[model samples]
Target: MKKYIIILSSVIIIIALGGIYMKHQYDERQEKNKTAESELYEKAKKRMTDYINANYEGIDKINFSNNYKMDQMGGINAEGYLNGDKSKEFWGIYDKSNNIITSSYVDAKEKPACKEKPCKY
Candidate 1:
């Protein structure tokens, strides 16, 4: 009877240890996933900035922040003051798949504006 009791206790301990190890592994995996997500977001933002710079020289010199958009053909949207001038603000939209800037609009005078619906891209 004593031997049987010892065996049962040992089994319970082993099972408990296993559960603890699994929980630790799960926590580690979650941390890694979070880190990967952050890295990906930063890389995408950089790509967006680079794309804008390639087209509009020196635009990348200014600080630009991007956010995930979820409305109306969602994509990464970034807007900031151009050439450090608040009045010259510009906004850009990056493609969701390639993280490439596809459309950009700058505030300027005497610009051909689009106010009507079904504007051609």
Candidate 2:
């Protein structure tokens, strides 16, 4: 009876330790993913802002939609309104090569057809 209790206790301890280790690993991965996502968002914002600054003059308010999508090719598409004007919608794409593919300000009432590959949002 004593030997059986000792074996059972050891097995329980091992399982508890394994569970703890797994939980710790999962937390670490989540943190790392969060950091990576933050970095990506910042980079996308900066590149989009740069594009706006270079093209549009005397514009201050740049509001980005909290909803951004990542393409299968590791590119990001960010959409927003220009100067807080709902009518003036902007869509920017950040490619994998750190290149700003397109930044377009379109009339919110009508979204033009996407003719080319990787068309507007």
TM of each candidate vs. truth: 0.49, 0.73
| Candidate 2 positional error at 62, Å | 1.0
* Candidate 2 error regions (>4 Å): 102-121
Model 1: per-residue Cα lDDT over 6-120, one tens digit each: 9999999999999999999999999996676556556556665554454444443555544444336645566666667777776666666755656766553321233332123
Q: Model 1: how far is 30 from its true place, Å?
A: 1.1
Summed backbone clashes in each candidate are 0, 0
Could you tell me which residue pairs clash in candidate 1? none
Regions of candidate 1 where Cα sits further than 4 Å from its true position: 51-121
lDDT of 2 by residue, 1-121 (tens): 9999999999999999999999999999999977876678778888777766555545668888888888788777877877778777788777747466554553333213332433322
lDDT of each prediction vs. the true structure? 0.60, 0.71
